[model samples]
Target: MIQVAAAIIEDEQGRILIARRKPGKSQAGMWEFPGGKIEQGELADDCLRRELMEEMEIEIDPYAFFGVNDHHYGATHIRLIAYRARYVSGTITLTDHDEYRWITARELTAFTFAPADVKFVEMLHSSKPRLNE
Candidate 1:
């Protein structure tokens, strides 16, 4: 089983960030929340922070733990822990993705996301607001 961490990074404007995977990468050309697999002994939040920095050259405040989704593709079983993150700092210099976009809930359906990510997206859409208005 492979353990992965993903962030549903949202800005103050209520837009969520999504990235399109670069060609030749795993699940290439598919869109996903910015994150990666967790290494040994690394906390899930720490892994997510490191991945966001490495992949997008940005820092994230992973203050909220959303939920987890378990998925299996072929012989690999993946456990994806999704977090509700707020943007902290740094410019997004796409190191691994072909493109990035800040999207609204309705815009989410237009992209072709990985099967695993699609589940989380649906969950996010159905979930209540994390911040109090």
Candidate 2:
């Protein structure tokens, strides 16, 4: 199974950030949380931090475990580990995505997300606020 780590980065207003997968990348054109595969031997939290920095040039402090999901996309299967995180610093400068948006949980359904992320989106919409402001 592919080990992945993703963040539910909430802003002061409680909106979460989502990124549009860039063309030429896996799941291109789909909107999803910012994260990447966790390398072997790397902690999920560390992987999340590294991915955020690499993909958006931002820093975050992940807190409170959110949830996990197992998904299969054709021949690729993934186990996504998600966490609730607070933005710490750095302006988001996307390098791997075509666009980015900050939307409230209720607005998640408005965008087309990668299939592997559909459950995460549902969780966010269904659950009470899990992260502290």
Candidate 3:
């Protein structure tokens, strides 16, 4: 199974950060969490940190474990390991994604996300999660 690490990035206002997949990419145009696949021998936390930096040019410290989801899309299968990460510092830069936005939980349902992310979204709904003040 493919190992992927994702972040539920929450800002001070309790808004979550989501990225839009670029054209021609898998799940193109879908809004999903900022993360990428884990490389061999890399820790999930490290992979999340690296992917955030690489994909969004932002740094994050995975402060808490959130949840995990296993999904299969027939052709490809992935084990998505998610975490609640604290945004540290850095200007937002788009590398892999076409666009990004900070949206509230109620607004999340408006956008389409990868199937693997649905569980995390539900978790956010159940917990009404917020960042540290």
Candidate 4:
């Protein structure tokens, strides 16, 4: 199983960040929490921090283990681990995605996310989750 890490990045205003996959990517045009696959000997948190820096050119302080989802598309199996993260600093520059946005949780249902992210979206129907506030 492929281990992937995702960040549900929330800003001070409670807006969560989402990224749209570029055309050449696997799930082209689909929106998702910005992150990448975990590498050997890397912790999920470290992977998230590294991925956010690499993919969005931003830094984050990830916290509160959110949830996990195991999914299969055709033959590809992935275990997506998510966490609530605070946007620390940096300008938004998407490297792996075509577009990105900081949206409220309620607006999440409007955008089509990658299948593995659906559960997380559904559970986040309200404003910032009841995480450590």
Candidates' lDDT values, in order? Answer: 0.89, 0.91, 0.87, 0.92
Clashes of 1: 0
State residue 47's C-alpha deviation in candidate 3, in Å. Answer: 0.6
| Candidate rank order under lDDT | 4, 2, 1, 3
Per-residue lDDT of candidate 3, residues 16-115 (tens digit): 8999999989889988888999999999899999999888889998888888899999978899999888888899999888999988877787888988
TM-score (all chains, Cα) for each model: 0.92, 0.94, 0.92, 0.94
Most lDDT-accurate candidate: 4
**What's model 3's TM-score?**
0.92
> Where's the lowest-lDDT run of ten residues in candidate 4?
124-133
- Local lDDT at 107 for model 2: 85
For model 1, residues 1-133, the per-residue Cα lDDT tens digits are 9999999898888889999999888899999998999999998899999999999999999988888889999999999999989999999999889899998766788899998888888876776654532
Which whole-number lDDT from 0 to 100 does residue 62 have in model 1? 91
lDDT of 3 at 24: 89
Can you write out model 4's per-residue Cα lDDT over 6-121, one digit (the tens) per residue? Answer: 99999988888999999999999999999999999999999999999998889999988999999998898999999999999999898789999988887899999999999999
- Write candidate 2's Cα lDDT for 35-107 as tens digits: 9999989988899899999989999988978889999988888999999899999999999999999898988
Q: Where is model 1 poorest over a 10-residue stretch in terms of lDDT?
A: 124-133
Query: Comparing 1 and 4 by lDDT, which wins?
Result: 4
Instruction: Give the Cα error of residue 33 in candidate 1, in Å.
Output: 0.5
